[model samples]
Target: MKPALLLLLLAFTAFQLALCDRNFPSIFTGEMSDFNIETISKANSIRREYAKKNNVANMNKLTMSFHLITIAQRLAPECEKVRPGSIYRYVLLKPDAAAAAHEENLKLYLDYTYARNRPLWNERVRSMEQDTAYHLEFLVAEQRQIGCTFANCTRTVRDEQTLEYTTINYGALCLLGPERLFQGDRPKWYAFDEKKGDPGSACLQGLVNDDGLCVLPPPQRGVTRIPKPTYIPPSTAPPGTAPTKLETDEINDFFLFNELRRNWARNNGVSNMWRVEPDYDLRLKAQKLAAEDCEKVWPTENYRYFMRHTDKTNKEVAAATHEIFKTKIDTILHEWDRKEFENAIFRLEELDRDTASVMEFLIAEQRDFGCASASCARTVLNPKTLEYQTIEYENLCLFGPSGKLMANPPYNYSRTLPPFNQKYGELASDCGPDGIKEPKEDGGVLCVRKIPRISIEPRKPVAQALVMIEPKMEMIQITAVSEHSLNWRLVAILVCLAIMN
Candidate 1:
C-alpha cells in the first residue's frame, strides 16, 4: 500500500493510561456502598481515546507527509497533479538518521491524490520535539500594548530637537488644569503692544521705545505660585491609612491541591506551624488581636490530644484559634503534588484505600492476548508466599535488539497449549509458519513463536501434582492448531469422549 492505513498521532503523548478492568482495588464495591467508584472512573477510559487522537509523534509524521505531498504538487504543477480535496492514508515511520534529516528529511509516503502515492524519498530521509527552539509566549504578550488604551494613555512621540521620547507629566489628568501642552500647542510672538500689552503674553508681547527698538516687556512682579494640593487622589490611600495588598484573581480553587493538602494537614484543629513555633506570624495584626497562644499551649501540649475529640463544637473552636495554611508556591502541579504526596509518606494507613475504577472504558485490552515487542507491565504472583504483584502496562510498541524481535517480545502472552497430539502435536502448538502472523512490511508487532512445551514430572491422575500452568497456559504465543490438523484433533477428542462415556 503506497499510502498505508493511516493511524493519526495520539493526543496525550505523556499520559500513561492504566489498563481499565473490573479488577479494582478491594475497597470499591458498588453504589449502595459508601462511595460510588464509577463516578470518578468514567473519566479514565476517555483519556485513552482522547490521548491517542492527540499523539504528538503520529501528528508529526502526518504533518511531514502532508508537507511532502504539498511540495510535490507545487513542484509538478502540470496535469491534475494531486486532487484538491481528497483523503489519503498514511503510517508513521521512524526517522532516518544518516541523511540531513532537517528540512531535507523525507521518509513518509506522499499522498497528493487519494489512490496514487509513493514513498516520500523513495530512499530519502526522516527526523522529535516538533520544534527545537522555545518561543516564549510571555515575550510575545509583552510586545503587545494589551494593558493600556489610547483613551486613558497618550501615544508616545519622539522629540524633534532631541530625537528622544518627549517627557509627559499627564497633568491633563487633573480636573482643574488645562491639557498638557504637547507639541501641538504653538507659542505665537506678537509685535510690541506698548499701549496695552496682553498680560498673559509675557513670552510673546514686547515694547517699543523712542529709538523704535523692540524692548521686551520688563519681567512682571508678584507672580503668585500655586501651592501643592493637600487633598489626595481617591485612588491613593489616605496618609493615615495603609494600602491594601493586591489579591490574586479569584479563579476557582477547584484546583483541589490546596483543599487536599489542607485536608491532610488538619487533625481536629491546630496548625503544625503553630504547634511548633507557638508564635507563628500570620501578618493579620491589623485585623486580628495578637496573642501569645504558643507559649500558653506549649507547657500543656494540648495540640497532641486535640485531634482525639469526636465532638464538632470542640473542633470548630479549635479551628478558629489555630487556622492552618500551607506556604503557596508558583508552579502549576509539580510542587503542589509533591507536598501533598508527602502526606502519604508518614501516614500510609490514612491514604485513600479505594481507587475509583473509572478507567475501564478508556482502555483496550488484548484480553489474555496482546502483541508487543515489550511489556510495560510484567506481573509475577507468589503462590507460596501470597504476595501482591504490581500491575504493569502493555507496551503499544516495542523495539528488538539488532533488527530482531525482543528476547521477551509482547507477541508473547499467556495461552493454553494443546495436549501433545503425537500426530498433530506440532499443528496444535501452532509451531508452524501458518499458525502465527508475521510483521508486515510496513511494520507491526506480530506473534513470532510460542514458548516451548513445559515439562512436569509425570504423576498418576489421582495423585496431587505440582501443575504449573501460566505465562503459557491460557496465554498466546505461537500457540494454536492448524486447520488441517484441527479436524483430526477434534475427531480424536470425540473418540476420547466416547470411550469415557
Candidate 2:
C-alpha cells in the first residue's frame, strides 16, 4: 500500500477506535434508555456521566430541560415526524404525556396528604372539570418522550453490531411510534405542514448515509408567526360590585362598546382589552330594598321622600321609585343615540392604551421565577438541567442541589437576552423581565458554581484498565437528579464524536 494511503487509513482507524472506546453511538442510544428507566440507580449513572462531560458541579435548569427534550425525542412516537423544537416546546409548554407516570405518583402523594381533611364535595366538584385532567395527562405523556432517544440510543448502540438499526431514530416525529395527538391534527402554534419546504422548518427529512451522522431537520422557517390571544375587557363596575345608579349608564355602554371595540382592535393589531371594575354590593343592596317594598310602593305616593324617609307607609311610593331606577339602565343604552356612541368610542381608545399599560406591567411581572414562565422556569424544574433552584429578585439562580452557590448579575428580565433566542422561543419574547439579552448564539452559558464545591483526590490509573466507579448511591435515589446525570453523559459522548471527528 502507498505510504500516504496507509497514513490516511491509520487516521480513520484511530477515529473509529475512539468511537468504540468512548461509546459514541451509545450516547444517543443510552439517552433513550435514560428516558424510560424506572430504576433510580441506572438513571443516576447516566446523569453523572453527562454532568462530568460538561465539567460543571451540577446541571443547570436548561441543561436538564435538554435531557428531557432528548428523552422525548426518543420515546415520542411522533418525534421524528414532528419539527425539531416542536417536542421541546411540547415538553415545556405541555409535558402531560411524558410526565404521566411521575405525575401519577405525585397525585397519589397529594391525595394521601389531603385525604384526612379533604371534603367529598371538593372531589365531586373537581370531577366536573374533565378538561383539567386531560390537560394534565397531556403533559405527563409528552414528558415521557423527552430525552428518551438519547438514552436508548446510547444503551443500544454501545455495540457496533447494532449501529445499522440506529438510523431508525432519525426522522419527523410523525414517523416515530404510536400515533401522536398532532399527527393528523394540525396545531395552531406549530406550522409543520406549512414549512415543509422551508429550510428553517423544525422537521427535516431524515436521510442516512453510509457514514453515521444523524441529520436533524431544517432550522425554523417562515416569518415565525405567533398568534396573540384576544383580550376581553372587564365591566366598568368594580369586581363583585353591581353598578350603582350613577354608573348604570357607564356599565350599559360598556357591553355595547366592547362589542364594537374588539372587532376594531382586531383589525388594528391591538386585541388586548383593559378590564373594567364595577361595584356589586351597591347594586345588590338597592335590589334587595326594592324587592322588600314592591307591593307597598306607589308611583305618585311621595316616592322621593319614601327613599329618604325612616317612617313612611309608602309601599306604593317605594314601588314607583323602583320602576324609575329600573328604567335608568334602559335609558342609558337606548337613549345612547349616535352622539353617545361616538363619545363611547373615543373613551374606548383611551381605555385601550390604559389596558396596554396594565398588560405590559403583567408581562413584566411574569419574569420573576420559581415557576415556569413564558421565558424560563425558575421556581419549577429547569427544562434544560431538570434542576430546581431559587430564582432571585433579578431572575438569577442562587444555589444548586449540593447547595453550591451560583450567583448571576441582577438583570432586567424584560430585556431580550442571548438565552432567549437560543433556548426559550415565545417565552423569551413574552416574558422579558429577566435581564437576558437575545439568547446567545451558542445557547447556554458555562457559569460554574464555585461555592460549596467538593474536592476529590485524583485517582491513580490501574495498569491501563478503566476504573468503573458507580456514583454514590444517594444521588441515584432521586429520580430527577439521576435522570439528569445520565442525560449529561449521553449528550457528552455525542458532542465528543462531533468535535473529534
Candidate 3:
C-alpha cells in the first residue's frame, strides 16, 4: 500500500473517531485540544481498520514492511538491500555509530556556518561603534561653536603688526576668555583679510601671535595669549579631574572584555565562558554603582584583575591568580559538573543490585530435555522464545544466548531423554508441522526442530542440572486424552449405565 494513501486514510479515521467521541460537529472545531484529539483519533482509527483488512500489525511493523517493499521496488540490484540479518545488525550495532557520525556532521555544519558569519558580523559592529564616535564628535563641535563657555581667559600678547606701538595687554582673556575656549575646546579658524596683505592669513582667532596679532574684528585679545595656555597635554588634567588617555584605553579594553563576557552569558549562560575566569563578583559589585559615576571605577577594577591574571611580567603571581580565578568561577558554575557528581554518587548502588540479581540466578534450578540431529539443527530456524532458566549464580545464562540476554534466537533446549522433551513439557505440546502436537519417541515432534547456531562466550558460566519431579497437574489432564481411548471410555460408560437401568 502507498504510505501516503495509508497516512491519509489514518488521518480521516482519527478525525471521525474524535468527532464521535467528543460530540464535535467536525474535526475543525474551535477548541484546540478537541481538534487535536479528533484529528489524532481519526488517523489512528483509519490506520487500524486498514491494518485489520490487510493483516498488518502495529504502525511500526507496518512502517517497516512498507519501507522494505518500497526499497525493494525502487533499488537496482547493485543498490544496497536490507535483510533480516541486516536489520539485526543495524539494531545491534549500526544505529549508535550512525547517530554519533550524524551528530559530528551536524556540528561540522554548525561550525562552518559560525565561522562564515563571525568576521562579517564583527566588522559590522566595529563600523557601528566608529559611526557613533563620529556623530558624538560632531555634536560636541556644534555645542562648542555656539558661545558655550563658562569663564574668562587672558592674553599675554596683544599688539597689531601694523600698529606696532598699540599693545592691547588683555591680561588673561587670550587664555581663559570663555569656557568655550577651554583647553579641549574646538579651535575655530577664519580666512585672513589676505586682501590686506596679512602674511599669517588664517589662524585661530583670539590667539596671540609672536608680535601680538589680533582677530580680524578684534572681539578681545586677553583670551589669545593666556601664557600660550601652557602646553597642557590632555594627560596633564588636574590630579582627579578626569581619565588620561592611557587610563581611558585601559578602561575601554576592560569594558570590551566585560561586554564580550556578558554577551556570551546571554547567548549560552555560563556555558559559553565556562573556560573564561573573570572576577564576576568584583565586576558586579562595582557595576551596582551608578554607571554615570562608577563606569570608570568598574573598568579600572576589571583592568587590574585582567592584569593580575594575564600579565606575563609577574609570572608567579599571575599564575597563582589565574588558578584562583579559575577555581572561583568553577565553583560558581558548579551545575556544569552535575553529571559527574551524579555518576559518583550512584555508582556503587547500581553495581550492588546487579550483582545480587546475578547471584540469585546462579542458585536457581535447571533441567534437561531432548536432542536433535546435526542436519536438523543446521537447517531449521528457531522461533523467538521468552523462557529463562537460572543456570549458575553470577555465572548464569539465558535460554537463548543473545536474545536470552533479553531473549532472541531460540536456544537448543532438547538435551535429555525423557517421557517428553523438557521444553515441550513446559509448553504442554511439541510444536508440530501443522501447529503444536504431542511428543513422540520417533522425535517427529515439530517443536524440537533446531537451526544452525552462532556461539559466543557467555558473560557468566552456564550450569547443568539433573532433576526429576511429577509432571505438572495440568500436563496430566492434557496428556491423558487420546482420540481412540476417549471414544472407548464413552462407549463403556454408556453400556454400564444401560445395564444398570
Candidate 1's residue-wise lDDT over 342-461, tens digit each?
332223211112110111100111011111111222233433345534333221211111111011222211111111111111112222442232223311112222332222221122
- How far residue 116's Cα lies from its native spot in candidate 1, in Å, is 4.0
Q: How much is the lDDT of residue 166 in candidate 3? A: 24
Worst 10 residues of 2 by lDDT: 397-406
lDDT of candidates 1 onward, in order: 0.17, 0.25, 0.22
Q: Candidate 2, residues 112-215: lDDT per residue as tens digits? A: 53455456424532442221221121211112122333222111111122223222122111111111234333322122222222122222122111111112
Query: Once model 3 is optimally superposed onto the true structure by TM-score, how far is the C-alpha of residue 53 displaced, in angstroms?
Result: 34
Over 4 Å off, model 2: 1-43, 50-54, 61-83, 86-362, 365-501
The per-prediction tally of clashing pairs is 28, 134, 38
Candidate 3 C-alpha lDDT tens digits along 437-497: 2133311211222221122222111111001101121122222211111221122222221
Span of ten consecutive residues with least summed lDDT in model 3: 169-178
User: Which candidate number has the best TM-score?
Assistant: 2
Question: Which has the better TM-score: candidate 1, or candidate 3?
Answer: 3
Comparison by TM-score, 1 against 2, better one: 2
